[model samples]
Target: MNQSDEVEITLQVCDPKIIAGLNKFIVYTIKGMDKNGQFDIQRRFSDFKTIRSFLLTKWPGCYIPPVPPRKAFGNLEQQFIDERRLMLEDFLKKIATLKYLWYSEEFQVFLKTPGEIEKALLSVPKITNEEIINKYQDAFSDLSGREINREIIQKINDFKAYIQKISPMVQNFKQIAKNIAEAKSSFQASLIHFITVFIPEYENNVLLEYVEQKERLIFANLIQNEDAQGLINQYCDLLKEPKFQELYQEVRKEGKQLKAFLETFAEREKYESQKANAESRQKELQLELQEVLAGKTTIRTLFSKGKKEDHITKLQQQIADVGKEIESYQFICDILTVLVGYVEIDKFKMEKQFQYYNMIKNIISYEINLSKIAEEFWSKVLKSENMQQQQ
Candidate 1:
């Protein structure tokens, strides 16, 4: 038969009790076969020949012995059933492991659900027993969602314990990292300031003046660069002083600001980019409004032929369409304005008293406030009659 026409056969023994019985029978058959005899033709032949020779020499007229049964004669069907049962058990164990692993939080978040697993399984043409085992092994090592979750909880507990046990030490380390970072920043700032201000004032004597009047007002202003080498030197000197050292020690007792500082620094770039985009969008909206107003100026020419009903209807439809467009733009603009703290609403041609105008403002305000932590700004804007009366 052609490969396509060939029928695929599979056994579907569903009863758990029957499966258990088959497994037991197979195990017993295997054990019995093992105990029956070793399958070594060479050894058997040697023993048989030696016995025959001895019998012939010791007592004339000895008969030859018959051959033993082959290993397959023990219990072939039972062995087959046992092997199948073992294979099925292994398969089930692997699937169970996968299920447990997939349910784990980490894995679940990535895989989403059991349906994903089913989909993946269905995508393949056919999965062999060996392939399934191999996949299970491969997937198990990385299936750390449960372990990761447990570790996360344990880590939180450990962190809390650590805080309780050596909070002072932890604080000290934090302060040290913070101090180092701050010192580095201050040193840089001081260098800039020195180059910009003090260096010019003192000229050749700048370094000398800085060192001599380290505690002076002018030097303090110059050394605000937290990363300046000169500032770091001054900090070390301050550490030598009893009063300053005591203050430094007390500050060290406070928790470090390293995490806070690093987090802020990391977000700075994203915040700046968002701010720039908001500003650009605001400008674009203003230009668009100018264009709309300029276009509205031409509306008077179109209406120069007395207010005909048809003309009025067309104008009204056009106005409505423009109003809808304005509403959409305003929605976007409002969000930008709220994020950036200002929006230029005068760009659109819709009158302040227009219903659409109020609708746009209200919708924008609602959406912006929904996203914001504080709604005071949005609330005040919505409360104004200027937007309401315009509609």
Candidate 2:
């Protein structure tokens, strides 16, 4: 093909190892195929084939075939090849950038210098060496920073000295600066390790024993205090005193009398109130009873004459209602009598005990009989009434 017909395709090599090795291979292929000190286009194609084969073997799923001579690759295959080429170019560019950054003069100097520890200390004026030591002490009082061991500290100090010596040589002290950074990091880490691993082992048992002893001492001192002794003595003295004994007896007697008076007063008040209400109710009931007993005042007379059946039904209902009212009044009166008798027995200070007791029993018996009479009266009134015929 003519030079114009030949497409110049740039192959971007990604991995440093791969780039180095492939570049060598390409150079060797170019040399081997050169004829009469001239570039051979066919030999370049052969190099492409060999490289393609190697890449396909390494990454089986990757690698697209070259377009056929008469037909260009389809849009999809062209896009895929474009994307792969872009990715490989990006990878190579990143490697070149990293190499430039790694070998820069500033980075080389940074690796060499003993960073100004004094400047850092001055910037943070509040954090002194004493403060750092105190912090370690507070965290782990038993295992001192010395637990990091003399050899480790000596090595760290030596690294610091070496960094300082090489600090003036800006280009040549990269390794020293790196060593100093690493040593500082190690020292800090060892301090933490000492506190975590060694301090607890040293102090755990001693702290427990010390705490127990302190507690015992505190308790012993408390028991020996004058206030504690005085409290005990006061309690004993109160138990033994004659005045206390007399006062206790008097209080007991007063309490018993007060309780008895309260109970008696409550009973009398209850009975008096009930008796007054019952008497008032009885007067009202007596008036009703008189009205009922007067044969002229029958239920038929109370309601105006209407339809005969309606009138009769109303009369019967009135009779039943009046009978229930009389029974309720009787029940209330009986309850009042029993309560009054109980109060009389309880209130009469001079009454014979047996007489008071007998009065209560009689009152209760009277109440029972009164109840029976009321029930019988009600039953008779209800039974005699021809209620169904009235309705």
Off by over 4 Å in 2: 1-249, 252-256, 292-391
Give me the candidate number with maximum lDDT.
Answer: 2
TM-score of each model, paired residue for residue: 0.16, 0.17
Evaluate all candidate structures by whole-model CA lDDT and list the values in order: 0.35, 0.35
Cα deviation of 58 in candidate 1 (Å)?
Answer: 79
After superposition on all C-alphas, the RMSD of every candidate to the true structure, in Å, is: 40.4, 57.9
- Give per-residue CA lDDT, model 2, range 1-391, as digits (tens): 2453233322233222111443321111111111112221212222333333332222111112221111134423443334333433432232223322222223222222233322322332243223433433343233332333455435434533543454445333434444554564465456434433444444444543664543333223332457544443343333232222222222232233233333433433443465466556656555544554454454544664555555445545655655555454444333323322333223332332443455456546644654564455334324432322334
- Model 1 TM-score? 0.16
After TM-score superposition, the amount by which residue 192's alpha carbon in candidate 2 deviates from its true location, in angstroms, is: 61
How far does residue 194 in candidate 1 sit from its true spot (Å)?
0.9
* lDDT (10s digit) by residue, model 1, range 1-391: 2342232222221222222444332221111001112211111112222322332222111111111112344333654344344433332232223333323223222222222233433433443323433443343334222322454434434533543566567666656756654575476567545544664466335644544543333333333544443533543343232222223332342232222222222232333354455556556544544544455434444546744444445555655554554444433322222211111112111222353455456546644543351243234334444334435
Residue 87, model 1: lDDT of 36
